[model samples]
Target: MRLLMLGFNHRTAPLELREALAFDNERAAAALHELRQRYPASECALLSTCNRTEFYLARPIHDPPTIEHLRSFITQQTGADADAIHTASIHREQEEAATHLFRVSAGLDSMVLGEPQVLGQVKRAYELADGCGAVGPVLHRLFQGAITASKSVRRQTGIDQGRTSVSSVAVAFAKNIFDHFGDKTVLAIGAGEMIKASLASLRRENPKRLLLINRTQQRAIDLAKQLELTGTDHGGRAWDDMDSLLIEADIVVSCTGATEPIVTESRFKPLLKKRRGRPLFMLDLAVPRDLDPKIGSLRNVYLYNLDDLQQAVEATTSGRRELVNEAEALLRGHIDRCMGEIRHRDIGRLVKQLRQRLNDIAQEEQGRTAKKLASLNGQSTEQAVEDLIAQHNHRLVNKILHLPLSQLDRSDPDASMGFYAAALRRLFDLKDQPDMPMDEASSDT
Candidate 1:
């Protein structure tokens, strides 16, 4: 079977297109089912997230589907047109596909380089596909190898060593504004992972109080309960009370899923008056942003969005670039170790069997020649024995060389086969070298 990894990622596609094709883990199994139905002979797995949507497939070797066919399948399923898929997709087969997946699982291919979330995302997608019977031998091997490489990268390199992700980076930025977090009231908007991650960072600071307001009441309550149970001062309220809470909060972090700004210039302009000129820092981590762009222009207001945080992210990434080289070396070591083990097992067995077969044929031919000489010529025992031994040795040498010569004469060769052929040439004195011996008999007529 041939492996195929086809996908559109943040580097290739815009955020709008990526979000349009986003699929959560809860829907992953169903997506795998759809993929299997479309290509029954193939084994498939789907990985989707905010930045990427990828299909890892294994097709029958003889009649594999084209890259265009896979792209069309995605376009039809995701409601994207041909042009949208055309500019934002790449397909890699076999070795290249494996390498791409290794880099992805290592977080090397992430929008935020070396971010830990992408590996977990891939693990979740892989588990769901396997649970749904969509993953076969090749995919299981492929993902397990990738996961193993990811683990090595984490342990062997410093690429993921610092405060990573937008949430954590935003929290780092917040520290620069506020001298101490213990006196601050941190208000978090929405119940999405961005807020959850921000809460994690804020909790680490031991903030005086935590406030949560989500569109869903229970979600806010759930987060509040979780924070309270973890020994953090916390409370939750309906979304309507958000404006009033904003007045009390020293720092506000919001990442909601609204298409438009939830906190506009008009809405927030009045809150500034009630606050009595207390400097407030707001971190907007949402895509399409929860806070209005003009909010940054307000007096005594510090606002930072995802775009503004690129300098910090780039600084962090630049530090990790050196570690990336070490991590890549570790990953290649793993791949080579695995491929070498498989090659040894398969080729070692074949070599053993072929040597045994050649020995049997050589012994049979030697017996036939000895019997014919005894039957027809009636030669003296000593001379006949000597002739038979010399001829048998010559025949064995010629027979062993037949296949090697055939392989060497081929104009083009498979990579694996060519390796073996070159090895044979070196093993015997077969190459055209100054020190090589000629194939002349030691004892002859």
Candidate 2:
């Protein structure tokens, strides 16, 4: 069997280029159907996510899909330029294909290293391929192996200690400080990517109230509406209300690209008193410091600046490097087990062919012997057929074993062929059977 994996990821292409080649659920199903029709012999699975698009293919060794075929199929489905797609693509074959899949499934190759969402995305893709009937023996084993490897890596490593991204780390830190999010109020500053990621993570926790304030009032309104948190007095407000907003908020995530500190200690000190000593967790994700550094030391106030977050990023980044080596060592063990299974399964086909060839030869010899017995002995047709059928069983076993016997006999005086003959006899269970030996039954043939 032949196996191939090809794809592009966040590292290999830009977002605009990735979007041009992305697939929705309906498109994914249609793409599989079209690929099956074009190459019926090949089993195919496609994994498309925000960060990557990967295709896994399996077929007979002689009928493997060419690189040109992959390029054409992608171009047809996504309308992406062939040359551009080629430039961004990564291709792997056989064992290397399985290795790449294992790494990706384990989230080692994610845009944000060790991100957990990728495993779920990959699982959904595998389920889709199974539903489409595109997963044959090779692909099925490959996916199962990848899943096992990923699970092992997660269980064995500390890669998921933090959420692995600045925004996600901010959410994790917030979660750690609060006992529950049911009554928490989150005031998000700036409507940018980091803020959006933090909002998405918070929404999963189901906070009581979410507020948005931005320099551009309309941008805040738009984000509030997008999050379905738009309301008269609760959702969107102008940046001028920062002092009043901080007094009511339990958590604040600021990601605006400001040149100077906006939330000074003097401006925030009065708000802390108004908060009645209630704890407030503030995350400063912006460059040039959105909040003053002195504000961090205030009573009932916990502020994590950009420098703090950077330290976290540096720790996780360095930690991931050490853990990745451990993960790869663990993955190799799983890959070896999968390769062993594939080798055993591949032998099944050859065994079937060998048996079928031997049966055909025995039937031909049976028919010839029956005709000769009828012509010379004047035997009835039924009697001749019954006699020949018994002989056919004997001939089948002998013919099946003829090659091993011949190889055993034509040997040098070194006696090496003796061991070969012993193995052949054991393989056919000739010693344990009730039937006479081929060498002893001289006239039976």
Candidate 3:
């Protein structure tokens, strides 16, 4: 059996393409089953998130699927062409595939390095595939191992010690600014990536109210619905209602892509007067400054521009560089261990096949000898014949297993000995089988 991972990520594709290829739960599950139909021997799992869309498959295909196969599959599923899919990378064979999975699970491959969200997304993908019966023994083992490795890295390293992205940092800052988000009202000003990310972070605090206001009302409502699915107490209004929400909001994060400032001093001056000095934390995450710079000069207004938050993020990132290195080291060790087990399993399968072939011959000979001995049972010679047959069978067994036994002995000591041992049990139908007893199993190939 072999492992294959094919797909595109933020490194390869832009957000537009990634979003185009995004698969919801139902679609993802269906796509997995369809891929299995196209390659019946393959077990498949699809991972689709904001930053990437990847497919992990475990199969026995002698000529494994190529990048083109993946491209065609994606096109068929999402109606997108090859050109639309960027940075399409493929990993084949055991070691590379294992390493790739390890890195992904450890968050080393994430768009936002060390983000914890991807691990949960991967776990959910595996669960979805398993539920659809699209994951077999190989995939089941691979994903389970990946999940365990991720947990180990998190525990052993400081990769997740600090807030990394603007959204995460914003949420962390909010915690410091206010006692709790549960009682505060959050106003999301746009429906862009940053806004969505911030909303996700805000939801974690179990905020009492979330108001999404976007230039496009439908977009805002859609985001609201999505957040609601994640158990957020969310609602949405049009950009026209921004003034009304602003007066009531305790915290406001604006990430609009407007060419001019969306929230200028002129817009907030009146609201500030009406509110009479209620403290408001405003975060301008847009490139062009969604909130006017002068807004920071207002009384009781704690305004942070993108540069300020970015500086904080950079500081935190520098402090965690050592942790990233440690996490990577942990990931490498896990990859090595998982690959070793896979190699051992492969060898065991080969040994089992060889043993089964020999056992078939032994069974045939035993049947023939028993029939012939029945005819000669009229004489005491039957006892002599039985003893002779037993000796012959013993010699045949030794001769058949000679090569495997020898190879096992000469092979690397730490190499998967279980592979050959498992083969012996499976092929010979051995009851209460013992270890290959390296000395005996490796006598002579």
Q: After superposition, how far is residue 409 of candidate 2 from its true place, in Å?
A: 24
Preferred candidate (TM-score higher): 1 or 3? 1
279-377 per-residue lDDT for model 1 (tens digits): 899988765568887999999899987555655776777756667788778888776665455345547766898889888878887787778667756
In terms of TM-score, the best-performing candidate is 1
Better of 2 and 3 by lDDT: 2
Model 2 residue runs over 4 Å out of place are: 169-197, 200-319, 377-445
Please give the ranking of all candidate structures by lDDT, highest first, separated by commas: 2, 1, 3
Q: What tens-digit string does per-residue lDDT give for candidate 2 at 351-427?
A: 88777887688678867776766675664588666767677667766877787666766645654686886786787
Task: List lDDT for all candidates, in order.
Answer: 0.79, 0.79, 0.77
What's the number of clashes in each of the models?
Answer: 0, 0, 11
TM-score of each: 0.66, 0.58, 0.58
RMSD of each: 8.5, 12.5, 11.2
The model with the greatest lDDT is 2
**How much is 427 displaced in model 2, in angstroms?**
12
Model 2 is weakest, by summed lDDT over 10 consecutive residues, at 305-314
